[model samples]
Target chain A: MNSTAQDEITAYVFAVRAALGDLPEAQRDELLEDLTEHLTEVMADGEGPLTDRVGSPEAYAAELRGTAPFVGGFPDPPTRPNPLIELRDQVLPVLRTADVKVGGVLGYERASDFGRLLRPAWWVLRGYLAAMVVAEILDGGDQPIGLLPRIGGSDGVALILLAAGILGSIWLGRRSFRLSTWPKAVLYGTSFVLVIVALTGFTQADGYTRDSYYSNVTSYDNPYSQVEDVFVYDAQGRLVTGARLLDQNGQPIHLGNAYCYDDEGTYADAPEGVYPYCASKAPFRMPDASDAPLPSPAPSGISPSAAEPSDAPATPSPSVSPSPSK
Target chain B: MDTTQLLKGVLDLAVLAALRDEDGYGYDILRRLRTAGLGDVGDASVYGTLRRLYNGGLLTTYVVPSDEGPHRKYYSLNPAGRAELQRSGKVWQGFASTMDDLLRERGTA
Candidate 1:
């Protein structure tokens, strides 16, 4: 018989056998021993299908059983079903229903039919994902991912690997169904793991895109990392606290950290353009400052004079002379 | 009345009679019976009758393998099958005549 004819005959026989399931095993086998051959003959001379010629398999099985109850050395009827057979009997209906229902939702006769159509697309995708794993391994996973993996930082290798991977994957996909049970199981396991690896690789690739898109805002090689606060000084060389620095176009000059703690340990925010983020932490000292401004030539003689006129002209001369010369 | 219900009673005899003239496969026998005007005789009924008669030692089967595809199983009536067919055929004839006479008087065509 042709393959289609063979398949139909096989299905017909299988249904007949299943319909005869209540009979003992040996009895059922005896009844169906010549079924395939018989079906082949019946289909050959029929103008229509085997079902149209013979009727439904169930009705056929009933007619077969109607004859000779004691002919085949019948054994006692089956006491209980084999566990595996029981499981199959219970599960087949639900699975068949799901196959039809899911298939209907997908606009196919069966879900497996839809799955068969997607196999080639999956083969290509699986090949690409497999190549990514290889590239990641070859590159030691250090390089940032691009549109395609550059194994060992070479575009040529990436293209070759991609072609080989996709072709090889398609080749394997075509033959996978024909594999023996054990090897097929192994392939299924590896396919699942490859899916997980692909998900992780895509997530990392997404993060890389975000980093490059916002590179100016946050960069690992920032030049001003050590600058905690900015302290502006005028040409007179006196510290200008609360000095807001702006660019030539009058845009605020934002640099350095803008937050600090005062001497009293109170938190403060002196956003950029307002230089000297913390006045108390300024690099330069003013007249009568807490650090005494500088080493006084006479600690006792001038210190009291400078302190008495805290805002007076005497502190300015002392503060100015020392700053310009030093 | 359903001819299928009637065919079930005489199917074994019909199968034996079909095999008497020439040995035939399952489908060949079905074709012969249909050609002989037992159009309502089913495929399974013939095949099933063949199996039961074979088991009862009244028919024999042999396989004829073809070069192209699946083989054919040919059934032929043995001596016991021929004898049973003749016996059943006579009984059917007697029943039909008796029914015919009873119906001819009681009913109009």
Candidate 2:
């Protein structure tokens, strides 16, 4: 064949090869070789243009595939790639990008046309949910909530839950369209619940910590007590102890005499002698009237009773009372 | 109604028959069929049928290297293929005769 005829045949062969895209590589190569041999022989006879005589390359490929035998023989020529499968192969990966996956949710194979149409809404919701997660993380404070607690706070649990929500939302968003009926439903349901809980956590987390701090301060019958005596409660409502009162630097602060008067003249938790006097002149007097008609311990002459000497400087130590006020 | 549809059913038989007299390459067989008035036969269909027959062990193939553009693969009938050809040929004849008689009777009626 002349070079012109050869180029024509090469181009035709290329098209045929492309059309046979779904065929196994070995089978396709063999088929192309056979067709090339046949085409060379046909063209040597000086036939007209191949396209004019052979029809389109795709139609030719279909006929070739229809009669082509498998390795063992022709056991019903391997089924062609269905149009829907072709569409899926083309569309799914493009839609699965992290940027586009939110919109791709409804575009997944099993998703209905109506669902595909709703992809814009899913896209918007995805943006909002992502923002909600970011907002939650930012507001969650510097200490991230991990699966385990470091600071003896519920912040970790809340943060972990929020993280789960973020992960679940992202996963569910990308694959929602591809998931089968019941599984998609379950995943969506789980995501919905997670997002709600996470959003609620993000909104209320600061208030939660503040309320818990106040409750903990009040949880102790006397906040001025020694570190070991400060009471706390577990989720089980059982009393827990050994908690220390730490300053901002986490160093334990001394609650001397464990009594001080507040700015409101209320009996406050303060160190002894720092408050200039006990919440009353008689220190170590228990607050409950029913427990005992207690005799004042100041005159009891307990040698280590430092509260007895400190009563004289009641007005001089105003600067020192500030430490116990906390 | 459609000869193309009928051709699909009988193309295997035609291919086996085409190889009976002497060995022929792919395009040679296509020319023989075209000369025998199968003008509508597709090049790919014939090539694919040759391959199917070769894979079925009904035909054997050998390459003939040429100074031309490409090597040619020639197909010949094996013993098993000859036997199949004879058997299927008999079946086709019987089916054709019966259909002819039925058509004649309907025409007369």
Candidate 3:
């Protein structure tokens, strides 16, 4: 027989067998064998189609059972439903109905399956944009970037923009917007690039560094506890002055020298006869004034005046004052 | 009346009777019964009756290989089947007489 005919016959026989599920194996097999033979004969006769002559396979099986009463009565067929089928039956109606309702509103009632599948893609993109908006807001001072204008400083504008993007994406996903081709390309491409840039900025943010916003805030420690030794030395290593020191931020105590807390700290320019009380808490001396001309002191460590002219006398400066003028 | 139901009751007898003179396969027996005026007889009914008779040790079966088509399983009445046909025939005669009497009375009424 041609395979198609054979398959048709097999399907018919299987349906008959399924209907006769309550029969004993031996009896069912015997009946099926006879039916097969009979069907073959009927097919050869060509009086009519098998189904036309015998009715449905179920009815035929039932008639077969009606003839053989000696075979024990058929039991009720068992009911075993597939779980995936159960889930699909329960879930598909709600999803399909939603699709239909939304599709109607969007005038996409006849949209292809490809368009329907695109909803999840839009949702994912919207989710990514939403995260970026949140991160931009949490970062506080960093400006939102992209083709869109800055919506102002706070995350509030970013938040509103994010909500708009999400809603717009959802509408587009549902085909309600049905944006033009170029517009969609521009919007998605811009958003994609913007999300990448925002991610990079978020990873590199270091706004919480020490000098930021907290630069001049004093420690809560007691002024007395904060005081330390404040001493000044001349280029020849002679002691210029001594007093109680203040903290680096100048909180606790203030010595006579205004140059102490200068931006250069220990490197401040010493007046002709006076020593510069360094802002740095570490003890240090001035740089050598004996050099061709005195150089401004560096921000850190003893000035070269103290280190270079160590072998010289304790003259404060030959041009400015006499030797015992300490 | 649904003679098909009535045929069901006598289908074994009819099928066995069809094979009495000469052994025939399932379709051949079906043709013989239809030719005998049991036109309402179901194909499955005749085929089932044949299988039942064979299983009841009343009929013997053999396969006749056909080069023209599929092999045919031919059913013939064994000695036991012949005895069954004789007994069943006598019983059917008595039942037919009773039914005839009842029908005649109904017709007159």
**Among all windows of ten consecutive residues in candidate 1 chain A, which has the lowest summed lDDT?**
A317-326
TM-scores computed on chain B for all candidates: 0.90, 0.93, 0.93
Question: What TM-scores result for chain A when each predicted structure is judged separately against the true chain A?
Answer: 0.52, 0.25, 0.26
The prediction achieving the highest DockQ against the true structure is 2
The runs of at least 3 residues in candidate 2 whose Cα sits more than 4 Å from the true structure, single-residue gaps closed, are A69-326, B67-69
Would you list the clashing residue pairs of candidate 2?
Answer: A256-A271, A256-A272, A259-A270, A260-A270
Query: lDDT of each structure?
Result: 0.74, 0.64, 0.65
True contacts kept of 3: 0.50
Structural RMSD, model 2:
18.4
Model 1 complex DockQ against the native: 0.23
The residue-by-residue lDDT of candidate 1 on A213-232, one tens digit each, is 87774346555444566654
Q: Per-prediction DockQ, in order?
A: 0.23, 0.28, 0.21
The root-mean-square deviation over C-alpha atoms between each candidate and the true structure, in angstroms, is 20.2, 18.4, 24.2
Model 3 lDDT, residue A69, Cα: 66
True contacts kept of each: 0.54, 0.54, 0.50
> TM-score, each model?
0.45, 0.40, 0.40
Q: Mark the regions of model 1 whose C-alpha exceeds 4 Å error after superposition.
A: A1-85, A144-147, A177-183, A200-228, A233-251, A256-274, A277-280, A286-326, B1-23, B26-49, B52-109
